[model samples]
Target chain A: MRNVAIIWKKEIDSYFVSPVAYLLLTMFGLIFGFFFWNAVSYFVIIGIESQMRGGGGPMSVNEYVIRPLLSNVSVVGLFFIPMITMRLFAEEKRTGTIELLATSPIRDIEVILGKWLAALTLYGCMLLFTALNFSFLFRYGNPDWKPLAVGYLGLLLQAGGLLAVGTLISTMTRNQIIAGAATFGVCLLLWVLEWVSGYETATWAVVLSYCSVITHFESFAKGVIDSKDLVFYVSLIFLGLFLTSRSMESLRWRA
Target chain B: MITVEGLTKRYARHVAVNNISFSVEKGQIVGFLGPNGAGKTTTMRILTCFLPPTAGKATVAGFDVLEQPMEVKRRIGYLPETPPVYPEMEVAEYLRFVGKLKGLSGANLGHRVDEVSNRCAVADVKHKLIGKLSKGYRQRVGLAQAIIHNPDVLILDEPTAGLDPKQINETRDLIKSLAGDHTIILSTHILPEVEQTCEQVIIISQGRVVATDSVQNLQSGTRGAETIRVEVSGRDGSIEAGAVRQKLEQVAGVSRVVLRESSPQLAVLEVESLKGKVVRGDIARAVVQAGWNLNELHTAAHTLEEIFLQLTGAQPTLEAPASGEKQ
Candidate 1:
């Protein structure tokens, strides 16, 4: 556990010391800010229209503003997660520092976890920046905070799953650009797996839709915490991390 | 402190380290001498737990590298051919992180970080980012990181590879000072480094150990016959080089005599004697009887370079033309 913390601290320090962390944070902030502005303005315009009509019920900010904003956060995460996790193992292998980590007393699991956790933490920080934009809703409106919190939890779990996948991909290669591009490709594929559900009801299509991460995140976005959704994200996280450890083990033999 | 038997590492097609075996006693600096791609680094990697041998076993500090790698890693500090350092990290931060990974913490970690930084002469650059430092400083930081935990065995691959002459000497002194507390295996192709710092030399060639012995023993034992250099001049200020070579060749037990250099006034020749023969006295007597002024006469012991070349079967590029056929 202590060794994990040591590696975690070193990895986090490296991320911030380089331009990667800042570039990621700034880009995420700008993109999410744009999405937040469009969502809130469109929600306000719809509220005004309904109020002028004097017939529709009060609009729920949770449904109208927060859900789409949180959903967009996940979409933004598809891009940012790769950036956060790309350099975790790839850079170390390229720079020869993996030799130091491999020869150290720490177990391979510790190093893997430390790096994955650091990526998660950096992603968490990006999510926190979006929280600043969400705070505006609480200050001016009577939106329920519970659903917003659940939405954030769902976003984190989803990001955790994707980051684990990124971590595994990072271990497979020493080139960060290749890792990043491949992670984006895999994430995009996972995101689009649900498209087949709209066209057909075949069992394989159902299974593919079930494997899509958005299917599990839908309940969390609506403030419904399903045990199956939690299990899906947790299992995905476990599978990705387990495969990462396996990849790390094989590296010693292949190196 | 370390032992290996029949250790071998095979890639997909080629063998990196062939069936090789050696051991190191506690508190001794053993020089792993080899040319490039000679499997020195491969052997060290196996011992350091960075890679497993394809066959056989290795133990460090009584811990098997294959069965108990965590225990083995706990006792070994390794510096690869390229120092395993993160360029983004500060020197002190990198050392502290490595110390923590090696199971040092609290005040002890801080103290050791300071000690190793000072010991490696990298204290002045502790706050400098490793990427910004010069190559010499970065190499020192790598050395400092390796010794931060003071493990039982230190495996350094080419510790002084990129340093200038002054830094090389300082690094050598530091390595020498590290003896008796840490058993170190440093691999290099530089023969003089082994002569200066290592107590034992293991010369590997083409994935196999060719010779393992002390520097002096390797120098003296490689050649079966003894050689002596004799320089003489005619008493009358001129000498026949061919006739002098003929006279020295006639001396008892003298197997071969080649004129190394000749001028009208002085002639220098190297005389090789048969095994177990003392031809120096007879050669001196022969020169005096011939009324030639013998200016200089001394035995020339085989250098490490010649022994390495002979053991590795490399062509001796520095051998004189006349003695080239003797090989």
Candidate 2:
């Protein structure tokens, strides 16, 4: 456990010491800020229309403004998660520092968990930027904070799953660009897997949609803490980390 | 402190380390000498637990590298051919992180970090980022990181590969100072490095151990047959190369003579005497009796370079009977 913390600290230091962490934070803030503005303005325009119609129905800010904003945040994560996890293992391998880690007294699991947690932490920081935008709703409106918290929980779990996958892919190659591109490719595929459910009700199609991460995240977005959704995201994290451990084991032999 | 028996690593296409076996006693500095692609790095990698041997076994500090790798890793400090450093990290911060990884903490980690920094002469650059430092400094930082934990065994691969002459001397002194406290095995293709630093030399060639002995033993062991070079000039200001070669060959105990250089004023002949023969006096007398001034008479001892080449079979020496007969 101590070794894991040591690796975690080193990895975090690497991210911040370089321009990568600041660059990622700035890009994510700009893109998500635009999405938040678009969502808020559209919600305001709709609220005005309903007011012009004599307050047709007390519009719920939770449903109208925050839900779509959180969902768009997940989409933005499809791009940012790769950037966060791309260099976790790839850079070490490229710079020959993997030799030090591999030959150290620390176990392989400690190294992998340490690096994965650092990526998750960086992603968590990126998510914090979204909270600043969400704080505006709480200041002015009577939106329920419970569902907002659940939505944030859902975003973290989903990013955890995707970042775990990115961590596994990062171990597969030494080039950070290849790792980033491949992680994006895999994340996009997972995202689009649910499209088949719209056209086909075949059992395979159902299973494919069931495997889609978006399917599991829907309940969290609606403030419903379903056990199955939690199980899905947690299971995805476990599988990704387990495979990463196996990949790391194989490296000792192949290297 | 280290034992490897028939440790072989077979890649998909070729064998990196063939069936090789050697051992190092505690507190002994062994030099792994080989040319490029000679499996020196491969062997060190296996010992460091960075790679497991495909066959056979290795043990370090009584821990099997295959069965109890954690124990083995705990006792070994490795400096790979390329220093495994994170370029963006400050030197002190990187050493602390490595110390933490090596199972040190609290005040002990800090003290060791400071000690190793001073020991490796990297204290001046402790605050500098490793990437911004020069190559020699980076190499020293690498050395410092390896010794930060002060493991029982230190495995250094090409420790002075890219340094200037002064840095190389300092690094050599540091490595020598590290002996008797830590058993170290450093690999290099430089022969004189082995002669100057290592107590034992393991000459490897083509994935095999060609010779393993002390530096002095390997050199003196090849001194069985003596060789002397005699440069002579005629009293009349010119010497005949053929006449000098013929006269030197006739000297007692002189087995063969080859004319090395000839000019209008001098003739240099290399005289190879029979095994364990004292022919220097005979060759000098023969030159003087033939009315030629003996300009130079010196016995050429077999150097480590010749022994290494002879053992590795990289090149046949000029005096080898087989090559001589072929010529």
Candidate 3:
């Protein structure tokens, strides 16, 4: 555990020192802020907020403002997750530092956990910046605090799962460009599977959607907390880390 | 102390390291000598617990590399062929990270980081980012990381592989200074480096242990040891060289007798005796007693290059078993 913390601390500092982290976080914040503003304007400009007084629509200002914030975060996630995860192990292998770490007394699993925690820490910071929308909920409009808190919970789990999965892909290659491609590909597959299973007529696809990042996030994103959904994301985080450890074990011999 | 027995590492159809066995006792600096691709790095990796052998066992400080890898890792410091470095971190930060991973903390970790930095001569660049440092400094930082924990066994694979001559000499001296307290196993194909830096040499060839001995023993065995050469001639063929050798064998301290290469009539022989046994006077008397004329005697000199070539490349010269013809 200390080794993991040591690795995490160094990695976090390294990320901040590099320009890449700052650039990605800045871009993610802008995109998220835009999504929330769009949701506010959509309800007001379409006269939907006013017309839904009798209809079963988002009549409250809180639903109009907060649901928009959570509604499109899942989509915005498609662009944001890969940036935080691209450098987990691929860069280490390319620079030859992987040998230094692998030969250390620390176990392979510990290294994986350390790297995942590092990336997730950055992702967690990125999610924290979205708090602006939450504050706006209580300020300029009515807000359903329950769904908003649940939305943030779903966002954290979705980000954790994607980070773990993306890190596993990063371990499979040395080129950052290739790691980015593979990470983006896997995240896209999981996200798209959610749509195919839940939105389309495929029953088995829907079953697999349980593994999709969205399936677990949907109920929680709407202010509903479910243990099974949390389990699915936690299992993913563990499974991704497990595969990463195995990849490193094989790589030790190859190197 | 470290022992590797029948260490074999195969990659699919090709064997990177074949069955090889050797040991390094406590406080001894052993040099692993071999040409490129001779499994010098592979063997070091196995001992460092970085890679498990395909079929063999290795122990470091009494811990099995396969069964107790972490224990083996804790006891050994390894420098790979290429220095593993994180470019963005400063030298001090990098060393601190390695020290912490080695289970060092607080004042002890701080002291170790400082100690290794000063030892590797990386103190000046402690605050500079490793990526911005020179290649030599990077190598030193790598050495710093390896020794930060003050491990019992230090495994350096090609420590001077790509250094300038001046840097090589400095690194050599640094490694030499480490011999008394650290059990070091360093590998390099540079012949003279092993001759100068190590007391014992283990030469690996084609993934096998070709020779293991003290530097002096290996030198003497592969290339004939330095010995006095004697030339002799008979005035009237009064006595044969064989007669002279029989008499010489009876002398107080003569050990070996052989015919000379200059001429068949002239006998050149090397006389080895127990330490402190002087046979020069006895040899002269024996030659005179056998009636053989002695012309010249001088100790033969052979360089280490010849010895290394013979030890590393001594394949069986195929010839007709009964034929006496020279190929």
The reply for model 3, stretches above 4 Å from the true place, is A46-58, A198-202, A253-255, B227-301, B314-327
Task: Give me the displacement of residue A44 in model 1, in angstroms.
Answer: 1.6
What's the best-to-worst order under TM-score? 1, 2, 3
Query: Where does model 2 exceed 4 Å of error?
Result: B226-299, B315-327
DockQ scores for all predicted structures? 0.86, 0.80, 0.61
Candidate 2 lDDT, tens digit per residue, B251-308?
A: 8898889888999899888888898789898888888888999989997767878898
* Top-scoring candidate (DockQ): 1
lDDT of 1 by residue, A31-87 (tens): 999998999999989989989889799899999988988888877788788888888
Of candidate 3 chain B, the 10-residue stretch with the lowest lDDT total is B318-327
Query: Which structure is stronger by lDDT: 2 or 3?
Result: 2
Q: Candidate 2, residues A9-78: lDDT per residue as tens digits?
A: 8888888989999999999999989998998899999999989988687889999888888888887899
lDDT tens digits, residue span B1-327, model 1: 999899999999899889989999999999998877788888999999989899988999999999999999988889887888888888888898889889998999999999999999999989988899987898888888888888889999889887888988999999999999999999887878888999999999889989989887787666667899999999999999998999999999999998999999999999999987889999999999999999999989897887889889986433221121110
Isolated chain B TM-score per model: 0.86, 0.80, 0.76
Classify candidate 3 by CAPRI docking class. medium
* lDDT pick, better of 1 and 3: 1
**Candidate number with the higher DockQ (2 or 3):** 2
For candidate 3, lDDT tens digit of each residue in B210-245?
889898777655533335567777867534667666
Error of 3 at A174 (Å): 1.7
